[model samples]
Target: MQQTAERPSTAASSSLEIKANPITGQERVLTEGACALLQALCQEFAAEVDTLLARRKQRQQSIDAGALPDFLPDTQSIRDSDWKIRGIPKDLLDRRVEITGPVDRKMIINALNAGVKVFMADFEDSLAPSWEKLIQGQVNLQDAVRGEIEYTAPETGKHYQLCDDPAVLVARVRGLHLPEEHLLFNGKPIPGCLFDFSMYFFHNYRQLLAKGSGPYFYIPKLESHLEARWWAKVFAFVEERLCLQPGTIKCTCLIETLPAVFEMDEILYELRSNIVALNCGRWDYIFSYIKTLKNHADRVLPDRQQVGMDKPFLSAYSRLLIKTCHKRGALAMGGMAAFIPAKDPEVNAKVLERVRADKELEARNGHDGTWIAHPGLAQIALEIFDDYIGKERPNQLHITRDVDAPILAAELLAPCDGSRTEEGMRLNIRIALQYIEAWIGGNGCVPIYGLMEDAATAEISRTSIWQWIRHGKSLSNGKLVTKELFCNMLTEELAAVKKEVGEQRFTHGRFIQAASLLEEITTADELVDFLTLPGYRLLTA
Candidate 1:
């Protein structure tokens, strides 16, 4: 089915100006119809989007005032009743291994051809959302859907093309809090969530449905069932507008936020018609947990590395997610394995073993699938799932586990003795600066010390530092965490980065800007909700 572009909406009362930054090949994807569709969606939903964002602030205020989130009392019946989501689409039924990365052209081709069951073409955490990058990401997805996506590296002289069989493509859009500065409706930037979802669904739904797949998505940073309901309404409206079946689009909500963890069943209930799975977005979940409980001394987290999945809080969260998802007959996906294979054989062997163990744990614990950041780890994850779930696509869903409210609550409030260390503080400072510099320069995913670092990791780094400083945390060396200490560490780390990246690159590049931005956010008296919002301004400038 060839796409029929809708003419740009011309109603003076509702017309929106398209202020997107021009890219060389953007015209192929951002058609008049696409703009019209996005404008219409934004105009229809902007007010409601504002209300939802305000609700997020209200809820955060409550949390800061010593309120704890629990299963909604009004929605207890939804949890009590035994109901399941709509059937999983055939293509998404067995997602034992999904690879995730930014939506760069080369990444789009390589990820799809990487042999994972699904490639989560990420526009959220893993993407640096410059206007050109965002628009070009949509263009890349459009071409990949048509199986015509290819890339030739200018420096490497290497060509990338799709293989005979490619992974299913699932797009992860930016969260609700973000705004697409380049795209405006009625003189205001539209929500990034609306822009990304509307554009992709507008252009690719028909083509994807015709190809035996539909527009699958991974919703991120959702804080409540109401937010899920908002997305449900959008899906319904888009399906009707596009003249497609009501349940054609399937989504998997990332159970990443503290509020979201308590409302998993409710979230699924809200989007029952189109929801298919729930993923353990571990990194952001940790960040959210820390941010949510920053004021409570007992809930202060230790070094970021100390907070692993094995921790009581994370383990309970994982177990509850599996039980909740499987109880609803939805796939319970595992968190990411962010460790990239190293060049040293000994290091690579140790890392691969850790990856294998992690996937094996997920497989055994009833996760239908897991995520791998690098393609090289895909086979390792796949083999674990294949060995454990052979012949049966997802063997563990049928097996049930018990999870009670007290268990979850206890885990959420679990105390840790893990100590902060000078090394950890220095590492966080170094990573925050390095990652932010790359992000400001239009690179979202950076490999530092053999791990794939993205926004989620970066968030944990900065937020942890902020929390430590705010709470007067003491490092193992008995030094109190203070703005002065952080500033001193930042200076040393900046010098190290300057030397590592070379003075020329450091000066001409965004390193100074990145360091300044990181210092400002980390030392600020008030916590900033997102690094991207301020960072986006720099990109636009």
Candidate 2:
């Protein structure tokens, strides 16, 4: 089932064709054992990943033809039955604050010591999946797992290392939709999720277990219960292969897609053996809402800024996630606080205040914990969650929130309130243009304006504009959104971006390419599923 490596100093799988240049640290991360695990994972589960992705397209076609997602009748009995997931480890129980970022060595060190309970080293949204970045990231995490990670800034010569009490580490693998472009197994690209999960788990699972933790994960972009089942099968298969305990590989699934909300109970049941929590992947969920209902004029969203967790649909989403998770004896982790800390004192204080308020809302709404992009936002979130849950408790899982009325599907899919404006449209256009530029340039986590823009937030920016133009929606200024209007505004925004970033940076940067790509997708005949798919081409080339 495995192909022998053609060369000693290359990707270790002969069955897997290495399509990209080998990075400096690729050898250790893609060791023979790691390649073997990847081959095994692909052999057993890769077909299912393709099938599930095809299922997503089939469902989207139905949605385009006027069908809405609802609870699964086939899984009603599973949802109704009283059951709980396998027990959580001690370190995972008090995850009141968790931070997520690209798996950069320095960033990983900083985030681990950021005073959060967990640091999710991300291989998904936050990291642009360049071959060098992916290989280097695996190496960094391997070092972190062994407590030998350290870095020194070249310009400043500032050495950085882990603190005495670092946060627990979790890995967020790429979604099933993404493929590891650098490697192909059995004549098809290996699923990026399996590649990442295999590499990390093979290298670090033993070390983490000895340190009183397994290889915890944050599963993203699940759209249905069957996807959850696929992961469950994957987890069990890996555990059996590795000769580990059945429930050693714990995870917290991200309810990011529009359809996932309707199947939360079944999703929990599917992974109950090893799953421990459900994260409110709000940004992606918003993006999914726009994409899923793009054809429905009545469901058009307003300005991106107006779609906060307080909105009817988002609020219902948060509450339902908590209710579903807590009822199923799992932690309900909150969404990301996208705002980053600023340099100016006033601006920084305002940023902290915003984060605090957002965390407060989450805590009051019964989330067991929350996520922050920057390490600086950790204190604000921890203070809020700590005040709510206190030092005595690990999580708020005991609070099932059973008293609330049922959250209807309509409420979860309600149109966001507030007016779209020429300004909001312009902001969306600018952010999409610049964010795509950065992403294609091998950086996925970028600070555009004040907020951190990753694939999820950027997805909202581009798709919102497309949805507006698709439905001929009007701004508060009474101006109709059209392809022509959007194109004109995009040209103006591109100029503005060039001016702000200066002549040298703009000329050297990917502004023109980004602008063209942004305009193409934003004004497309149909909304693209992901801009990254196209952007990845530019990145790899």
Candidate 3:
């Protein structure tokens, strides 16, 4: 089996590859005078960076040196007469675990009744931003957990309906990146103090546990195994202080970052038995891809509609995740297929059809279950997963268990020339473009010429590709690809696609689209055909 954690870094090296800074790419040209002044100021007042770095280093060292609390409760010690998480029932394993939209509590209840093992009452990205909406969401969750929720208005200012029903599994709280105090909309922060929101979240977990409920969570922005380790340590601290059990606080991390994909095994290893599931997060994943490839100017942001699901890195990453999780007997969940529909009935129908088609693809590709944001599309996710499960065989793809394909390819194509090089921008594009070419030619797996390769190698390549694509640039480039060349290319392309994406532009969907288009240009006739696709025009910026 592949190691679940990263091996320690080998002994240090001397010379390192140097590349131009990313911040200087466009900013220097656009605001040369101001940029120079700012650089001067930074040189004079750079102590803050050192201070922040020192603090972070200290925090990590403290965590590493800290011992597991003696009061840490055993997760297995908790006994619930009504529910259990010891072992996934065989019947449940054979069936699908579905997540429904938060708008319709009725649909969620219905899905739970239908034997779904988890129901995430999403509050983060799915729910629109607002203080009132958030507080109301908490109340709704509390009521739902107690089975005292009411669908009918009680004439006054409340609604109450009593029942003895139990929630299949409840995920509460939201805003993973932003804390409650930082909650803002349209550049305005929402004001409402909960004394200490962190304490509130922790205390809520304690209360839920005391009520014989499992302490479950959906951890987002899991960037690295270290981040995962931090969450584990934090959970340990809370559990100890609250007099709760260790393994009782189960969590399913949302794979939402480039580094997280590469560090999946390590993150899982760190979380261990506390990890209940893993979901492929799409929107943020796409955003991260843009950030990853931000180095290449030619790979401008693509139109949202142009970003296809058939991209090479996404498929490989998704497959790698499923393989890793399944091999360890853990649930590998397909990430959310955001089924946003238009107000027009005709447009809505088209949207629903697209969602159904995508769900079908996910089911056929090896996803055990998927997410749906709209209640109207709840039946679509359920029905599609059910159909696949009933067939009695998992989706088998062109990509096999050989996991070293992409990693070895990456190493060969973008080898570590060993100078601590900072030329990731160019190398990432070249490698990604090449990967796409191979993928389009029915060569789904990366082929490493004249090098040792294995499943672990392939998984790392997929993970690395996804990470590079996430940011629209690689971390190194001198020995890989230079930042100046990338910035020049981006400057040229940005003039064309800026209008399509509009103002407040930060994503790089346009870039992915361009690369996808260029990859199809093996022949002149094929180039025309590729241009006809929506992505060609969208990729200009």
Candidate that scores best on TM-score: 2
Task: Please provide, for model 3 over 138-204, each residue's C-alpha lDDT reduced to its tens digit, 9 standing for 90 to 100.
Answer: 5555556656556654376544343344334545334223323222222232211111123224325
Q: Which TM-score value belongs to model 2?
A: 0.98
The worst-scoring run of ten residues by lDDT in candidate 2 lies at: 1-10
lDDT of 3: 0.44
Q: Write the per-residue lDDT of candidate 1 for residues 393-458, one digit (tens) a residue.
A: 544677467644545576755776698999988888888899999998999999987889999899
Error of 3 at 23 (Å): 43
Q: What is the alpha-carbon lDDT for the whole of candidate 2?
A: 0.90
Give one digit per residue, the lDDT tens place, for model 2 in 141-169. 99999999999999999999999999999
Cα error of candidate 2 at position 538, Å: 0.7
What TM-score do all the candidates reach, one by one? 0.96, 0.98, 0.52
How displaced is residue 170 in candidate 3, in Å?
3.6
**lDDT score at residue 150, model 2, on the 0-100 scale:** 99
lDDT, each prediction: 0.87, 0.90, 0.44
